[model samples]
Target: MAEKGRPRAFDRAAALRRAMVTFWELGYEGTKLTDLTAAMGINSASLYNTFGSKERLYREAVALYDRTAGSATNRALRGAPTARAAVEAMLRGNVDTFADPETPSGCMIVLSATNCSHQNRKVAEHLAEWRRTSVAELEKRLERAVEEGELEPGTDVAAIAAFYATILHGLSIEARDGVPLERLRSTVDHAVALWDSLVRQPAGRG
Candidate 1:
C-alpha cells in the first residue's frame, strides 16, 4: 500500500521527539491518535507501523523524555564535585527548567499520572521506576559522602534521599501549576540550606 514514488524514510528519533512534546502538552487521555499523527507528521498506518500502537508510542515518548530531561538530573548528580553540590544541582536544575515560561510543555510524567486512568499503567510505572532509581542513586551518593567524612557516619542517607525526592515531586507539581521561577528558586534554596545543616563536620573541629 505504499504510495507510488513516495519514499518511506521516517525518522524514528525525530518522530519520538515530536510525540514527546505532544504528549507532554496533552496528557495520555486527552491526546487522540489523530493529534499524535498530526504532530508526528505521519499517517495512522505509518504511525502504527513505526511505533506499534498508541500506547506503545506513548511509552516510547515517555522513555525519550526520561532520557533527555530525567537523565540530566542523573548526570548532574554524578558530575558535581561534592555530594551536597550534586544534590543541589539536581534539584535546582529541575526547578529552573520546569518553571521556565519558555518551556512549551509542562512536566510530562506529572501530567500523565494525574490525567490518565489505569489504562496508562505502563506510563505510571515508568515514572515510578525513574523516581525510585533517582532516590536510590542519591542514597548511594550520600553513603559515599559518609565514607569520605563529608557526612556523619550516623546520618540516615536513605531518609535524607527520600526527603529530597519528595521535595522534587512537589516542585514538579508546582511547575505544572505555573509557579514563578523566583518562588521555585526560593523553595529550592530553603531545601538546600536544610540539607547543608545536616552535613557532618570534621572531628576535633572548633
Candidate 2:
C-alpha cells in the first residue's frame, strides 16, 4: 500500500467507468468480483483497496452513470420549450442512449438490482429510490409546464409522469432485448402521442 501522491498502477476513474458499463450490462448481483476486476483491468487487491468493497464500487458506478449516460433526460426536462416537447425529448434521448452499440443496451438504474432477494433488499431499495426520484423530477417539471401554460391547468401530472416513466423503463427492457434503434425511436413517438389527450383530461379523474 502506498501513501497519498503515490501513483497507482491503473487509472481509477477509467476503471470505474468500465465497472459502470459492466453493471449496466449485467445486474449488480450478477456481476462477480472477477468480472469487475477483469473489466477494470485491475486485480482484486487494487479493487478492494481503491473502492472499499464491491457494493461501494457499484454505488459509485451508478453515480457516474447518473452524471454521464443518464444526464440527457434531465436536460430535456429542463431545456425543452413545452411539456410535450420535454417528454418527447426525454424519451427519445434515452432511447438513443439505450440503443447505442458502444455502450450497454439498457439503463443502469432500472435494469440493475431489480428483483433482489431478501439478503439483497438494500440493493433493490437503493435503485427504487433512484427511480422514485426520477418520477418526482418529472412531476416537478410537468408542474412547471402548467405554470408556463404549456400543460392545461389542473392536469394530473403525477399520473402522467408515472406513465412516461413506465414507458421509459419498458424501453430499457426493449433495448436490452436487442430492439433496433429506429424501432425504439418509433416507440417513443407512439408514447408521446398520448400527451395531448393526457394533458386535456380533467385533473384527479383517475
Candidate 3:
C-alpha cells in the first residue's frame, strides 16, 4: 500500500488568527481560497488538510471573534452598575471597536455574510442567527432592568432591545462604509441620552 501523507508542522492558533482577519476584512464569499493561504502563509493543500474546508474555517474564525469581540460586548453590558449605563457602555464601546486602527472596520458577523450567493446562503443564515442571539441577550438584560425598577414597569423591553440592536447593526454598516469615528461617537452619545426619556427613575431622582 502507498504511504500516507505526513502531517504538516505549523502553529494552528496563529494560522487561525490570520484566517480570521482575512474573513473579517473580506467576508465569507468575498474571501478567496488563495487569500486565506497567502495570509496564513501556508499552501492550499496544507490549508485544506489543516482546516478541513473553507466553511468550517469560517465558523472557527467566527468563534474566535465571539471569544474576543463578543466577550467584550457582554462585559460592557454586564459590568456597568445599571441597565442604562450598561447599554451606554456597550454602544460606546462598539464605536471604539469599529473605529480601532488596529483592525478592520465594522463587525465580522455583520459584514461577513451580508449578501452571499445561494451556495453560501447557509453562512448568511448562520450569521443572522448569531445576531438574533445578541438581540435576545439584550432583551434579557432590559427585562432584568424592568424588574429592578430602572425602567418603567410597563416598558416594552423587547422593543427597546430591538431598537438598540438596529442602531448597533447600523453603526457596523456605517463603519464599513467609511463613516468617521467622531460622528459615530456623537450618535452613540445621542442614543444613550434617549435613556433618560425611556427609563423610570425613582421619584425625585435625575
Candidate 4:
C-alpha cells in the first residue's frame, strides 16, 4: 500500500463523557487545552484530530449534558399527570441533581459557559438560547394545561413559564454556591406553592 492512516486508539464515547464532566466542572474558558487532554486521557494531537477544536469539543460537551443531565427535567415534564405536578417534579428533579454525589452540582447548561468574555461571547449566548428554549418548553406545557381545563382560561402561560424558568436557572447558581440540598428543596417547595395563585383567574375573569 502507498499509505495508510493509523487506527484510532481511544474509546471516543468514554473520552467524550470525561471531557463533558471536565467542562461541566471547569466551564468553557476556564478549561485549558491541557485540562481536556488530561481528563479525556488523550494527547493534544488526538484531541485536535478528533474534536477539531476546543470550542467544538466544548459544544459537544454541552450537547451531551443536555441529553444526559437534562433527562431528569424532560422526564418529569413528560410524566407528571398535571401541569402543577409537572412543575413540581421538574423543580424537585433539580434538587435531586444538585445533591447527587456522582456529578458536579448545579446545571451544566446554566453554569458551564454563561460568563464567557467578549472574545468568547458566543459561548455565553449559546447557553442563553438553551435557557430560552427551556422556558418555551414550560410555556408549551402550561398551554396544554389551559386547553385541557386543568388551568383557568385566563392563565398567563408565558408569565408562568418564564417565572418557573427563572427559578430553574437560579437553582443552578444556588447549588454552585454550595447551598445545602435541604435548603434547595425548600426553595423549590416555595416556588411550587405559588402555582395556584399564578394561574388563578383575575378579578371578574374566568
Candidate 5:
C-alpha cells in the first residue's frame, strides 16, 4: 500500500514494457517477483494492485510484445517493393535485430513458445496464431506478386510462404543460440538466393 501523501506516479505502459523485456530475457519460470518489481520500478503492493498477480502481468507483457513486434514485421512486409523483397527484408531485419549484441533480450514470443510449460497454453496458442497470421500475410503478398507478373501464375504461393516462415523460425533459434552475426548474415543471403530461384519471370521472356 502506497502512502497517502506519495501518490503512485509510475507510467503503467512503460512499466509493462520493462516487464516484458525482463521476462523475455529470463523466461517465466526464471523470473521472480522481485526481479519484475525492480525492473518495473514499482513496489510489490503496487504491482499486485495494478496487475493482480505475476501470471496476469506476464500475460499482459506477452500481449504488449506481440503487438509491438508484430507491427514491426507487418510494416516491413507492407513496405517492400515486391513480394520476394518483402520476405527477404522481413527475415533479414529479424535476424539482424535478434543477433545484435546490443539487443539485451532476444525475441519474447520465440522464448515463450519454446520455454513456457503446458499450463501456459494461452501463451503457446497466441504464438501459434501469430505464426499463422504471418504465413497468411506472406501468401497474400505472393499472390499479389503473381498478379503483377512478378511470379508465374503456376507458382505455389503457399509453399513459398511456408518456406519463409521456416526461415524466420530458424533465425530465432540461431539468435537464441548466440550464433555469430556474420554467419547469420551469410545464412540470410543464402535464403534470399533460394527465394529468388522461385520467382517467375515474364512468360517466354527469360
Candidate 6:
C-alpha cells in the first residue's frame, strides 16, 4: 500500500468551532464519526489525527463552547450592576445565545452526554463538574451581595444560587425544544423581580 500524502493544513480552530456546534446540536451519543468528519470538512484519517478520538474531540468541543457560546452567561454574571441584575443578565444572555439563529439551541455542557451508559459515565461526570463550578461561583456572588447590603442578610446564598442554576438548566432544555426567545426573556424578568422583592432594605427601615 502507498503511504498517505501530506495532511492538508486546514484551520484547526475553525474545524473546532464546527465540531462545537455539531456537539451542541447533537448529544455525544447522537453524534457519529461521519457526522463529525462531515461537519469539520475533514477526512477520517485527518479527523483522527487532529483530535485523537471521538470522545476526545467531544471534550475539546465542549471546552471550545465554554469559551464561545457558553461564555455569555459568565460575561453577564461579571458585568451586571448588582447580584440580582447579574443573575438576570445571565439568564437573558442564555436565552439570546441558545435562541440565536447561527448556532444550536441548547447548552453544550447540559445537553451533551447528559444520560450516557456506564462506559461513557465519565463524559457525564465531566459535564456535571462544569455545572458545579458555575453554581459555586453564583453562590459566591450571592454571598458577596449579602455582605455588601444588596441582598437580605438572612438570604440563603447557596439555595438561591442552586435555584437559579436549576432554572438555567431548565431553560436550556426548553430552548432546545424550540421555546421562543421572548418567552425566555419574560421568565428572566420574572425571576429577577422575585430577587428584587427580597432585596435588603436600609438599616432601621421597614
**Local accuracy by lDDT, each model:** 0.78, 0.90, 0.85, 0.86, 0.78, 0.84
Candidate order by TM-score, decreasing, is 2, 4, 3, 6, 1, 5
- Which candidate would rank higher by lDDT, 3 or 4? 4
- Candidate 2 lDDT over 1-206, as tens digits, reads 68987546889999999999999888999999999999999989889999999989999998999989988788888899887888999999999999898998889999989978898898889889999999999999999988988878889999999999999999999999999998999889899888888888867886
Model 6, 93-144: lDDT tens digits are 8878878988888788889888899999998999999989999998888888
The candidate 5 region of ten consecutive residues with least summed lDDT is: 197-206
Model 6: lowest-lDDT 10 consecutive positions: 197-206
Clash count, candidate 6: 0
lDDT for model 1, on a 0 to 1 scale? 0.78
Clash counts per candidate, in order, are 0, 0, 0, 0, 0, 0
lDDT tens digits by residue: candidate 4, 1-206 = 43477645899989999999999889898899999999999999999999998888888888888788766677777899999999999999877886677898889888898888898998899888888888888889988998999988778888888788899889888998899999999999899988888888443443
> Which candidate ranks first by TM-score, i.e. highest?
2
Clashing pairs in 4: none
lDDT of 1 by residue, 31-101 (tens): 89999989888898888888899888888887787778656577777798788998899888888767766
How does model 6 fare in lDDT? 0.84
The prediction achieving the highest lDDT against the true structure is 2
Error of 4 at 17 (Å): 0.8
Off-target runs (Cα >4 Å) in candidate 6 are 1-4, 197-206
Model 6 / residue 193 / CA error / Å: 1.5
Alpha-carbon runs more than 4 Å astray in model 1 = 1-7, 199-206
RMSD for all candidates, in order, please.
Answer: 4.1, 2.4, 4.2, 2.9, 4.1, 3.9
Model with the higher lDDT, candidate 4 or 6: 4
User: Candidate 5's residue-wise lDDT over 69-155, tens digit each?
Assistant: 534567667899988778878877777667767654356766655656788777667667767887898889888988998888878
